[model samples]
Target: MDHQEMADVESQNLETPPDVFLKGKHQVTLKFDDVVYKIKTKKGGLLAKKRETVVKEILKGVTGVVEPGEMLAMLGPSGSGKTTLLTALGGRLGGKLHGSITYNGEAFSNDMKRNTGFVTQDDVLYPHLTVLETLVFTALLRLPKSVTKEKKVEHAKGVIDQLGLTMCKDSIVGSPYLRGVSGGERKRVSIAQELLINPSLLFLDEPTSGLDSTTAQRIVSTLWELACGGRTVVMTIHQPSSRLYYMFHKVLLLSEGNTLYFGKGSEAIEYFSNFGYAPSLAMNPSDFLLDLANGIYTDEFNADHTIDKQKLISVCKVNCVAQSKPALKGIYDSGKDQNRLQEKDSEKWPTNWGQQFLVLLRRDVKERRHESFSVLRVCQVLVVALISGLLWYKSDISHLQDQIGLLFFISGFWGFFPLFQAIFTFPQELTMLQKERSSGMYRLSSYFMSRVVADLPMELVLPTIFLFITYWMAGLKANVVNFMYTLLSLLLNVLTAQGLGLALGACVMDQKAATTLASVIMLCFLLAGGFYVQHVPNFIAWIKYISISYYTYQLFIGSQYSYGETYPCLTGQCSIVEFPSIKQIGVHFGLHDQLMAALGLLIMLIVYRLIAYIALMRIGVTKN
Candidate 1:
């Protein structure tokens, strides 16, 4: 074929959509039997001689089945284990979970998790991304590769339409500090993200928790539509409106971690009525059910003669057997159907490592650009650099005191600034990262590695500019090689500082706590920094080894004074040497060579990053 003909063939191939093997509808029936979850808690003061550990059961023998084409809304007051039950069925619970959970008669595994999606109560989303960008990114990372690029884009658009987000497609999903989409729209965007993969089963925890009545109705209505299309949906809701209550096909009522009632939503009112807890014409059915569950009764109902809790449990247990017949029959039918069908391979992550990194890099870049603090950050750097240059204008080695002073200032400036900037990096994105991590969007390594790589350009840019303006203006080192080494040392110092910051952020999840701890630690390191105390006591002298500022000061001074600057003696005569050479000074502190110091900085960078990675892995994603 000619060159033009080959090009045309490639173009056609790029545009052609890959064949989509629709394996019928993804109708799933999730069944859980006697699932019990518990956690151990410590009860004691910090100074107590002995601490007691107590085991608390968060979920108690929860057994139920949610069939496709049905919506199960878990209703209960606060602290009633509603969200816990939903999470258990969603396969998100960790630790030793008692009992069995099966999908379509098969036991639950990672495959079941891959085919399911969960939407938490909080809307975890990229605040700086537009609705379209957010959904497209999710689609790229989620949808199978067999789906063409065009098809994925079309799919994202379709989800936006389905979620009633077309009006805000171009609007940015903003946070508390940034103004963009409304709360309702942001919630829809969160739902749209999970909808990209067309999950067979969807679990939502309070989908309408913070939304207004109308918006909540719309969200629940959307779930109803999804159920009608053969997707099993289980959600936890508290005090839903009457209209919203009827939208759910089934309702699972709970109180104090025990099932009070489980049956069709329509039958719940009648079921409660049979027990003498029926609602008046003016009262909402949902309100009456909640009242009954919480042991609250209005004047219309005799509070003195309230229905006994044990009696109600006995009635619900008897009804559960009758109510489960349809679900058991459905499971049996599904088993027979499965024998005649070809078992399709479970879905895997669509993107490769390189692709994930690239896409994440692009998204991070876009987010950083839109962040209001980003512009402020650049301005802050420039202003600080300019001020430092002005403060130490045309500094010379004629006075060794001034030279030492400049070195200490340079050390402190780079140490403090970059450390705080890096400190907030992990904590700021902790929620979003944890949410995406739970969804299997990308590996922690991919995210951490890509983030480090993505930060390279910006992380270096400001330091380079600061070095250029300050080094020449301060008249530190005039030679090109000396200037380059000085610049490289400062850059490495910044990287090391940032690494420490990231480690602190990951080790401590709370921002205020991490910030406070980082400040204290940085201050301690600063005091141990060489210039602050020329002669350190032997007792605390080992601290110098871990202080980046100490090494930076050594390299900064060594790189400059190694050029043999003449110092004025007491008698106004030039002294050949009063202090040791920069290399010799570093040797006294165990930084034997400039190469060794640079290598030490690099080592610190690697060590801290490893620490952060391990901390993140250990403290996995938190559900609460």
Candidate 2:
């Protein structure tokens, strides 16, 4: 059968009740008029002596509408403002936007946000997570607290079934390097995540860009069914096959930031034909439309017939002005209804603080479990621990220098390892975080706290294991109290270093730059850690005070030996308090005060994390 007939048969088989998911929810009617978006960009090369700021318009006076139970497909070539206009309609665009975009004759509000779903082209998913787990976590975080946990899971399963993902429900989402779900399945999973919220309006960016033709048809058909269920679905697409073209209820063609055509998909050919832009032979409607928008003429077109881009834009502008007047008037006439909407939209988050924290913490733990406990990471820690243990195996008291060096190595190893590992946490997850936060899944504070809390145990486990293996082999101390003190100090040091890494990652938001800065900072800490240079220059002496390694080394030394402990002197004579190792560690300068060293580390633990939290708050949720 042909595509249209195939689509007709499939639609008949796939039809369901309109209110299956959106029952009792508001049905949104999206309308935009005179929408224009511009950005300020610099116009000069890096080596140029001078640079100039220029305002570039991305969308120019574009207008259209998609009411309940209809789907609008935005079509254009690259740089035609298709994505920009879609973002504006979705209320996610920022920077010099001049337009009137309304939902159900009301301005965009928190309520509208709560009821809208935006699926980005890139599927921001945890590759290790099963499709079921992914959707369940989304439902738990985004659904209102009124729904019980069991009911939320049920809803997620329902969405999975609705989108034909039941077969892959237990499968991992996967990534480029890892084998998992197929590309089409991944796209549906993205759509399923948004559908968990039962949004009244859905916006997607090129939902079928990289898929095969059959998969693309299936995705578009699924969207058609969603629009059939009373949701306003709008998406940007490149050239689509004629079958998929006919699936959309409305088609909006854009060219160079201007609207080329808007109205019913079935009538688009007739509308364009009226302008004498019809193809002489059979052609995919989308192909023909794109050629006109891109100013490309096929062999089928008459050699003598020429089309002017500006003239087409002018005609579309006049047509848009005439078509948008009535819808714009209706929007202006609903001031009272808009006020009611504003009041109804007061709830900023669907779940309270505590609930958001618990749900997010659980999800974070599940998603990161493999990374934190992978065989490779565990083996790395074990190898390092074994090497350190064998190198420092049970030395005599006369070898005080070697023992102290081992302690310093312990401090330096942990201080470096955890910080480097933690630097990738924020930069890698920034995109996913922005997507979830923009959809109002939870508060940034809640997400931040849950993330830190979830990582605490995982971050500490390896270090604890390493220390247990290395401490006994090196015979540092046998007393339980002393061992506890050393372990506590090591854990605190790990946390402090990790906190610094988090701060750096959140501040820079770039993995390479953050790692580079972290390397420089860690090296400075190590050089001034009091083990390498006994007396740093007085001008820069304060560096040791803030160094996590400095405090940790002091704590390790104080825990391993007593203030008046004696060691066999190299010269066969020495005072108990004047031993070379004791003098080298500056025990006389209060370096043996374990309490003070621990307190310093404790302060850094709080301070660095506070800085990280502040940086995250500044990063905030991306609205543009």
**Top candidate by TM-score:** 2
Model 2 regions more than 4 Å off = 1-21, 299-306, 334-342, 573-585, 588-592
Best by lDDT: 2
All-Cα superposition RMSD per candidate: 10.0, 3.1
Q: Which ten residues in a row have the lowest lDDT in candidate 1?
A: 13-22
Per the 3 Å backbone cut-off, how many clashing residue pairs does candidate 1 have? Answer: 0
So what's the TM-score on candidate 1?
A: 0.90
Looking at model 2, residue 470 earns an lDDT score of: 92
Off by over 4 Å in 1: 1-25, 43-50, 299-306, 329-336, 339-348, 371-373, 563-565, 571-577, 580-592, 622-624
Residue 228 lDDT in candidate 2: 86
